[model samples]
Target: MRKWTGGMLILALATVLFLSYNFIGKEPHKQTAYDFFHPSNTSLAMGSSSHAKSQQRIREKPHLIDVQGLDDLYLSLNMSEEESRSLLVWAQMRPLLSRSDALPDTVEGIKEAATAWKELLSVVSDTRNISDDDPGWKDCPHTVTSFNGNLSSNGNILHIPCGLIEDSSITVIGIPDAKQGSFQIQLQSSQVLGEAIPNVILNYAVHLPGDNVTDEPAVIQNTWSNDLGWGKEEICPDHRSNHSIKVDGFVKCNALVIRSSTEVNVNVSHPVNHQSTNNISVGSGHMSVNFPFVEGNAFTATLWAGVEGFHMTVNGRHETSFAYREKFEPWMVNDVKLEGGLQLMSALAKGLPYSGYLTSVLDIEHLKAPPVLKKRILMFIGVFSTGNNFERRMALRRSWMQYDAVRSGNVAVRFFIGLHKNLQVNLELWKEAQAFGDIQLMPFVDYYSLLSLKTISICIMGTKILSAKYVMKTDDDAFVRIDVIISNLKGMVPDGLLYGLISFESSPQRENDNKWYISSEEWAHDSYPPWAHGPGYIISRDIAKFIVQGHQQRDLQFFKLEDVAVGIWVEQFKKQGRKVQYISDEKFYNAGCETNYTLAHYQNPRMVLCLWETLQKEHEPNCCE
Candidate 1:
């Protein structure tokens, strides 16, 4: 001991501390449900607060014990695992499960939590039968009641999920005290027959006086989803026109319409009944198609009852504008019917199962976007993706994306994906968003031709929502050398400018049948002004704000060719005598890796991994350090 060296002194101290923790941490073991899932390490009693029967209750409801970080603290003095798990599920179920006031520590409460999770999970795949035991199920005012002998052989009321009926039935959802001009119905569907995509209708009606089987004007019908858009790729069977879409709807004055308003051209906009023939629904028909029901996807359809008529959003993007055809008081309208042979996975009012207490497919809030942006985010590399591009997004996540600069919050890198009509992809996207918390799901339909709108949407989100000062919009297939980008951005004067390998005098594609094709009708201008290629580009916060704020509903004349559209915005700004600087940096190459580069694009997953290796080798010191 007197002759102890540095290593010897460290060993002596380690022995003392280890013994102290072992002996001082002495506590009798108690029953803990948390330890049953993940055994605690602090050496507590095996029987402290832990009961075998209480643990069994928690095992029945596995979803409740998933509360993260519950293992960090010991069971606070006699807090039983059954009570803790019960409380966690109780709090979550207030909004998620039944609205019933479930009391804790009682066996009934535990059963409620178990039943809620079991029912929620069971109906996700097939919403066929809901429990009749919950008294609240059959009593809600907004509950759907079957009428007109739709399924009278089974029961006057349709099964909670309305069964797998081949024909659309006359079912009424009762809304109580519904005297508000604003009402919302959250719709989710897991299975939609391919044959029913064109004729699904949701007509809103109010409970008026005198309805013993024949008083007209008794129902104020706010028709939603009449003559909406559908993909032409399935009908046409051509890859080039694979991007082709069609809008089939019926509108007299305020008939429902869903069409792209930004992409200028009949082939692009496809609007039927609105002012811009290019931007709204058109055609005379009886049946109104509401939601695009893909076979396996679970999508959120939000329809709001407004004074004018109704406003709807498929995910979050503005879907379509419908004016009111019926003159009844808007606030009094409550009941919404599933007409036009519509199939549904779920229909919930105020998030409660509305179809006579049918099971919810899944909590709609599970897909809600996470809070990603922090106050001091210096820059963002926004990767534009679609619902289907899972591989490319994952490659970026593993390679250069896992950097200290990104993890430390100096550079916030995220992928922005648009919703696809394919329900399977949307469901996966929702789960991915939950896992990474780096994904922003825009509720716009992901058409390959609408890439420019996607770019504009991300730009708007970056500048306005995320408060990112500098943003680099790239594809899922692209990779940015984060260290170098952070270095370059640190020295630049950041505003009113776009940076990339700029192209000047690039002529617009006039071909009629190509992805990049532009018709003279869509754009009268001969040659496009110098614009950055779409693979990658950079912009300051001001430039991002300028493009988004100025371009609204075809305001900047958004052509589907996103890069060209951006160039158009830059040219317009220059004409207005505003500073529109184009920083032409060759280092921002469009393909593969280089010895010294700011960014690279169109690289596959394997190449990205190798490029990240090379990027690390090319020594660049941290500029901030």
Candidate 2:
């Protein structure tokens, strides 16, 4: 038809210009004010009730500038210069139009306020030719005024003020400047002390003593005051802010201004009895001092007065003397009785000052003695009593072997008795001398001749008493040092062999009862024989008569650990060629406690009273006087 009606009128004019450009670029429908004060849109524009009384008279208008004085110029800095030339002549009579423009409801609003007063005089002549410094002039004289108005033809409203000057020269306009880079400055005030004191003073003085009291002048009183409040006519004993002073009932006083500071210190707290009355003096009115009686009763003074670059006046005073007097005594040991060992040998001769020949061999009258022993040694102590304190273990083994054989002038001790309910002269529980002694009480002896006569009567009285050239045996809590065991065995083995302490093995079958067990199958025949354990054993005297003539044809038996039955009779006298030696040089168990042993064993009675107080305090001399 006419080219399809011009292609259907160009597709209906491109769908009506794309629906009018998507309805004018969408994004707007947000009306509410209750849909513009709906009463159904005021009754659909109220069939015109005078257009709903002119829209409720423009929503009851009446806000004529009162934006709550725009939060008082945040922090003013006193501005001025005639309120900055009347806010640059009110922003040069404002008028850059466009605030929906319609405010000229009159004489063209005076040509839009004369073209905003020529553009606020070209922004105050470009803020006075900007060369910096001039944050609106500050030398205090505040100002910050602003104003805007249009309110109709599309709203507008601003107005800030904050201008000050007043001291009655009147200016004051404060309150305004609702933020957005606002300004103002100036502040000052603080000094306190009732504005630096002008009236408050006090001073006093007093002294009395022409050899004791009364010369009149002495009643100085103003007890106390702090932050002022009492006596001396409501504060004034020299501005009574009392620092301290109290003098009551006296016996000592020579001079006293009791309280007047600038610099003073007199403290002598009592202790000098020459019949009381001391002295002190200062002047500017009554003086005559002599303070010196310090024996006991009480004294104190410290004054540091004032006036010199201001403030300083301390005072503390006190003086009491109830007629002083003191005397006491009693403690004298007549200059250290007996010159206490000549003052510990003159403090070890001035700390060891012996220059040569050991100072004549430490002169104890040129010492000489210890070195003499021509045989005569016999120490034997063997007690195996079977319980109930056998006569308190034979009177503690005959009083410590007659006090170590009369303090070792060649020892000689003996005791070989073991009666634990007899086991037939216990000779080694027989079984060909059950390899020797009651091998740990053979299953607790149910009598086998009471373990063969207590093991062949202790192996024939321990080989006829360890045959003596130096025999020891032991056990009454063995403790023998008979002069360091006969002076270390006549000075280190002076003839033949035999010392003691040998324990190759025999800790009683790691003991833990089987009546004090001892079973490695009764020491499974020989594994450690060179022995020594019979509560401290020692020998020599011809190996104690060859073990008492080899226990006269062995038969009696009973060990019960007599040092592993004397190490199986010294391993059967070393297969009869006689040689049982293993004395790792003496020191047999100080199982007692403290030691350096020449011999020791069970020791008790508190280790013989701590080895008789560690040998009378290690060799007498006022042994712990």
Candidate 3:
């Protein structure tokens, strides 16, 4: 075995040198019309006749086949020259290559497999002609440290150029209108160039107790996105905390009360009896408390960015704290908007980030030539992104992609982006692709339904192009710990490995009203196979190769959910008498950031940079503060 391995190693070295001179040294291989094979439909309901015709049509164009490359591939797989030659001969005679472990029995099957592989190999790079030139990038630094302004009818707006950082505070002095019943203070995201409206990071609303004697003042805080409206509200004097009171006779409810120089508390009282005996003290001592806001009464409120969330202090007393929500980071809050029935006296912001340098310590010199593809990569990361997510991509480049493993070429990262319908977006995307050599542009237009194609493309790149040992699929919004993931993979089986935050018992979303609705026609199964969350997951090379081969041969069933499709393929591979190891780790946070996470998902651009900064400063796997 040692002699055979030694001979194969030598043969592999020789083949690499030849291929390096011919292929690697030359310009990147431009994709051709036949390079990409778009599936007709995502479902496998099509007849065998059409499938066979499609296979035959694809096999007719076998000019891209590199028979010598097959020999090299087999040699690299630790096969001796004689064994490699035998396999090649058998592959040509095989009837068809249907599965990963199934070897061709006849010469025809071998030829079909080789043809499919060669076609897969033909997809080297994006076909669109784009230059590799640096597009000029300029820094937009925020020099304004403070802003003080009086309220207008529009409710004074104070713009935060570089957004807030830790300990950043905004103070407002306003009086609730006597005639109005409610007022709102909002921390909002800056409107993007093409976006119709900005996102509301935090909406703090106060409903006043007006002429209605039965009504009591209430405070509610929540987040809102332009895509998906308002999130769950976390109100002051939390209803969940009012478990002490029963609603049978004298119903007792809690209300948040703040004093100018005393501790804040939730005062519980029985409204029907107006009894002081029912009053429950939440602060230091049992004392009468009052609401901070009063009709036509002036008040001072300060909102400070904290490590966990945003903390609000009314009249020098802590009132409420809203824990940051997923996709809503403090740094994304670029504008303080006061609306509703408030007469703002003045507003002031302090300790906000003044420059990008304070937030992201991105080395521009290193970006000129990012460490990528110098040698065989341990893992290939394909981040799914849209054409307009330039900021997200840039954040990734500046953050986790700067890790030693990635910079040293142990891990290669690429953004798998699809074209946009808008010409201007496509133009900007082209420029970005040209500037950054890490983008893998797909041929099809970007659509939520077509995401499966990008996953297949990642497999192709990982197996046929980079020949990585493991292939990981994640989103551009996620932060991946490359060294930690590599360390984890080291202790696990190297083949048929599907590692991530796996979901074992999940059913398809049959509801048509949902975004992830899976119709019975698209998927016949009642329960989906165990699969990792879509945000991040890893699979070994054998499984990736199988997926690529299955895709090329048109044997793999396409699913709209890319991660589930991978699960289906992995399950099939396991059925082929291969030992499949499913490693489920909770550290792979699919929903939001957490301490010591393997991969934190649903992060915005600001959070990505923050995560990186925290990791660097602390030298530990800590989420963004």
Candidate 4:
């Protein structure tokens, strides 16, 4: 009996030991805020042993001190310890990892940074294996063409469901408010969220005579975009010029206004020439007919999209025709806004093309399959994007990604996006990621303040994964001509090339209200290092590797401005006795589109499609028509 009891005890002990080793003694499954959005195919689960080894290696280093400022930075970001450490391990300081004072000096801090670095690498490394298969196509439903409405008051807005096209015409019947000095009719594109102002495709203003008796009425026409601000004004009937208005192929005033009769006692002071007096029509002959637009005038104006530009006919007479600017294409105008002194009675738009008619030629749905990275790439373009910018991403895919370089896998492009605050958006983004296979999901909440992390992510992708000869960082709203850029890069030296619209002397914005604001606490310098504009910039593979390795070794510096941060890194690389060629070319347009631009920034989705179409048809660099 004693032997049997002992045997039972040993069996129970052995069973308990096996259970403990299998479950209890092992690590718990880690949960992240983004786990629900992350697909199982990707590496959401962490590898503890790898992180442990990394932490051990970091802890072995001496002369490490605790960085309290970095702790505060992590707090300010409102990220968990793991995320904060991951960011620090990715890039030190707020933006770069170059500040020795900001480096983790203590064993605990070092381990945190190192562990975070390993986790980030593990998550983003999966981007290389993303499926490149094309998602099957789906047909789009029909869309509206014409819009009509009345502008009842100042600042009244009307929607054009389908933007304008050739032969599209808009007619407005309104009376100018006499008390107001000026009124404006504007054609506006769809407003984007982050843009400070909506793009104005056309700005038509009519200024009435001032209080001064010598003042004359004026008419002006122009175009405006958020990036370019405003184009040259096409003013009519200059007060200094002949009363007969002439603006070569643009403006001609043939308006007739009945002059107001004011009785003036002649007193017979001088004998007025009978012939001259007869020259004046039936009454007091001061005809206010030179300017087409006037105060208190009930006028019917029709504006139509024509071959060259937009033509305006006021009261059945052609008043003006404004030449088309580079990027303000007729189809880009999505809505009309009426402002100022006009009381609009009715508005009507006709002959507008159906929504898909203009863009159907793109055949975005039936686009070619996404290119697989089979060989070494000449360039890897990492676009910084947000989770909800679905249209923008699709536009890029349909437009520039169709280039031969990208189609042949000589160039690779991927969007780096972080998790969205909204779960629905995250789900959609995940679906998009699965469908496109061109997006790399960063494991963090997306914010403008965290954009520097995206820059680091780009370098990580370009060097650690795709192994491209050059890495270029650009925005989703930009249009990049891959072939042109590649041709530009051909003659250049391969190593340490930093190419873009370079800014040689730019001061750091100190005011808190500025968009690119940097507090003295963040950067104690007066001017930023020579850096390329953020809209588009390129660096050689070696520089990209230095950025990646610098973060891994805890030596790179951090700056809030990504472009300026890159400049800081390149400066550090130069300090290491390496040569860096800073190629500042104007062809990389930092603002809106220009003639023969290599890359144009702030282009809307429609404009992107238009640019691509123009490039293909013309076989040259041309702005969107």
Q: Which portions of model 3 miss their true places by more than 4 Å? A: 1-150, 159-173, 186-204, 211-214, 220-292, 295-336, 345-363, 367-376, 383-405, 415-465, 474-494, 501-528, 533-536, 545-569, 572-579, 584-625
Q: Best candidate, lDDT-wise?
A: 3
Task: Write down the TM-score of every candidate.
Answer: 0.43, 0.17, 0.50, 0.47
Candidate 4 on 1-625: residue-level lDDT in tens?
9999999999999999899767544553543212211224323224563543211111111224444334432433334443332232233333332234331222223333343334333433454322223233211212222233434444666666545655678888888874654677788865544565667787777656544443444556777666665566665543333444232244433334323343222111111211001011122324345466666667999988764578888888787767665446565566787766677787777765432222334553444335555667899898987655666787888899888888787888888775443332443454455445677765444435556667878888777766799999999989998887888899999998899999989888886534467887566678877899999999999999888776555556456678898988887777676899999999888768899888998787789999989888888778874
lDDT by residue (tens digit), candidate 3, 1-625: 9999999999999999899766544442433222332232223223353543233122223222333223422323443443232122122212122222221121222332244333322321333322223233223233333333344445567776546655679888888874554677888875644566677888887766455533445677777776666676655554445444322221122344522222334332212211111112222323224777778788999988764578777888777777665457665667788766777777788775432331244555575325554557789898998655667788898888988888888888888875443333444554455455677655444545657767877887787767798999999879998889999988998998999999999999997534467887666669988999999999999999888776566555567778888888887777666789999999999878888898998787789999889888898877765
Q: Largest TM-score belongs to which candidate?
A: 3
lDDT tens digits, residue span 1-625, model 2: 9999999999999998898657433333443222322213122222434643333212221122222212221123243443232122122111111112212111222332233333333443454532125465222112222232211221111111111111101111122121211111101111112333111111112222233232222212121112232223111123233433322232222233333442221211111321111123323332223321111212222111111101111122332211100000000000000000000111000111011221223332212111125343354333443221222233343334445354343443322221121111121111111111111121111211122223333333333422235555565555555666666666554233446667676445444322335565444443555566555655655555544444332221224455555555555545545555565654666344334666555554335444545664575211111
Sorted by lDDT (best first), the order is 3, 4, 1, 2
lDDT of each: 0.45, 0.30, 0.64, 0.63
- Which runs of model 4 end up more than 4 angstroms from their true locations? 1-373
User: What is the clash tally of candidate 3?
Assistant: 15
TM-score-better candidate, 3 vs 4: 3
Kindly indicate the candidate among 1 and 2 with the higher lDDT.
Answer: 1
Worst 10 residues of 3 by lDDT: 270-279
Kindly list the per-residue Cα lDDT of model 1 for residues 1-625, writing each as its tens digit.
4666877988999998899667645544553322332334333433544633222222121222232222211123333443232122122121211212111112222332243233333443342323345453332223344334221111121322311111112212322221221122212222223333221122332221122212111112222322343222111111123232322121211222222222211122223331111111223222223322222334455555432334444445334334433212122122333322122334443321123211332432332223445785677777777554555566677677777767666666667664443333444444455445677654333434545656766676566656788877888767677777677766777877788889987776786423356776556568888889777888888767767655532224445677777887776666555687787888877755555667776576667766766557755422110
Better of 1 and 4 by TM-score: 4
